[model samples]
Target chain A: MKDRVTTPLGAVTLLLLLVAVGLGLSSPLDVNQGSLVRLMFVHVPTAWVSYLAYGGTGLFGLLYLITRKRRWDRLAMASGELGVLFTVATIVGGMLWAKPTWGTYWVWDARLTTTALSLVVYGGYLLIRAMIDDPERRARVSAVVGIVGTLYVPINYMAVEWWRGVHQTQTLKLLGKVRFDAAPIYGWVLLIATAAFTLLYIYLLRVRGIVAARDEAREERELMNDLQGDLNSLTPQGGLRG
Target chain B: MDKYAVYVIVVYVVTLLLLGAYLVWLAQRLRATRNEAGLTEQVRATSTPGNQTSSRQTPGKRG
Candidate 1:
């Protein structure tokens, strides 16, 4: 029996689904956007989670640099992978929403473009990890990329305001009088959706990080055994080196 | 269903599909890793002290 305990990720995922459907069906639609407002429940949460994932990747990468621990590297890589997936979701959801609202399936708005660039850069970060076989070197390189790639997250958020893009400003902003300007039910749905997605991200991070750590440990053991076998073969006698 | 309703449904559907697929992929990886660990444990058990030399000698006869 080796680490046979079940993970809570699936359980949390089921809960998220129930909450998502509940909100989707019951939340009030926007006056202008009509039923199309329902897309916000999924779109906004995915976008927020994508940013959270990149932020986690950067934070874990910094921790790895400070502590020189393989666990930190594993966490950073897991977050990066999740960030890429969430970004894809965000992009797809946005396009779907935009097609009906903006009358276009694609746009080159500042926010959209910057978000796409963020996806590409972070995606490169994952590719960097895959290209490097040496764990230590891979961690070092990915940590650098992870930290730098996260700079795009803030830029993506601010792109609309700074550059006068077609993509509207965030409904939820940190500064400027905490206002969502939507129905209270819409706000509640968005809040619950955000929490659910955030929980989902954290759960995935934990499970993915554990799996990554185990695989790395297993690989390390195999490598050590191979080295021992080689040493035994090269030795004058059939014994380990003193 | 309205056209906008269809768009919203598609978006949610795609989101669910992508995330669901990711979870499934992670589950598969975890299962495979567990199986590998179990196989490794069985191999270690079989190659106990008494059979270590014989197990090492027959490189082709792996568990």
Candidate 2:
């Protein structure tokens, strides 16, 4: 059992994360924000990974609908679960950083509000899935939820611009003209941290998929056992089922 | 730096704890399932009428 748990991907992720942390420490601090800026290494990437995980959930959900495959559903479910985890991380990181800078743990900033809303939507997706016992029906119902819940992601992203919220505007943009507004060293460290966290999300997704697949298999086995028991009860002691 | 050290430590530590907990739990779960499935396979093999040899050396055969 000890030997059975090897994970090359996980090991790599850990190493990369260590490197990211080292870079973060060595990088210069913000002139105004000071050492508190180091929190961005975790904060920014956690938010990005949350968004990525939710997008993965919606993508897999769409594929499940199109192909009617359990694999897609399992991936979608894992993605949604991890999406929630990362979002929680984002919130925690944000709060921790906010206390030092904003002098408060929370504010009614539009970005924060929308991110919280998206969290609730995905949380409901998991809750709804748990309520349905039928595997096919559970997948079908949650696939719709997963797909629709992710519609909030874009809104969450645009919240800063749309509402002109207190949260800082996007300083690192991937599309359109590339933007890296921070110090070059900090930018590189942030990039590495982002890449590391993204990989971490993917590795966790794979691990969680195994859990989902095993659960499905166990349910199928239990259903089969029930059917076998029913058959045994129907047949005579010395007959076919016996 | 020392003034805000607690916040940085908390964020990094909490993130690590959360991640490590989930990963460890997943590994334990997968190992438990693998062992359970193996046990079930061995039971089924040994219980079948003609698997006397397998029954006698089920652990050995698997190893």
Q: Per-residue alpha-carbon lDDT of model 2 for A1-242, expressed as tens digits?
A: 34344388888998999988777765676788877888889889999999999999999999999999999999999999898988988898898888878989999999999989888999999999999999999999999989898898889988888899679988786657988888888888999999999989988898888878877888898999888778777887934535
Task: Provide the global lDDT of candidate 2 against the true structure.
Answer: 0.86
Per-residue lDDT value at A83 in model 1:
95
The reply for model 2, stretches above 4 Å from the true place, is A1-6, B52-63
Cα-based RMSD of the predictions, in order? 3.2, 4.1
Provide interface RMSD per model, one decimal. 1.5, 1.6
Write candidate 1's Cα lDDT for B1-63 as tens digits.
Answer: 345666677678888899989989998998899898889888888799987787677667755
> Which residue ranges in model 1 land beyond 4 Å of their true spot?
A1-6, A236-242, B50-63
Best by DockQ: 1
Candidate 1 local Cα displacement, residue A231, angstroms: 2.0
lDDT of 1 by residue, A118-144 (tens): 888988999999999899999999999
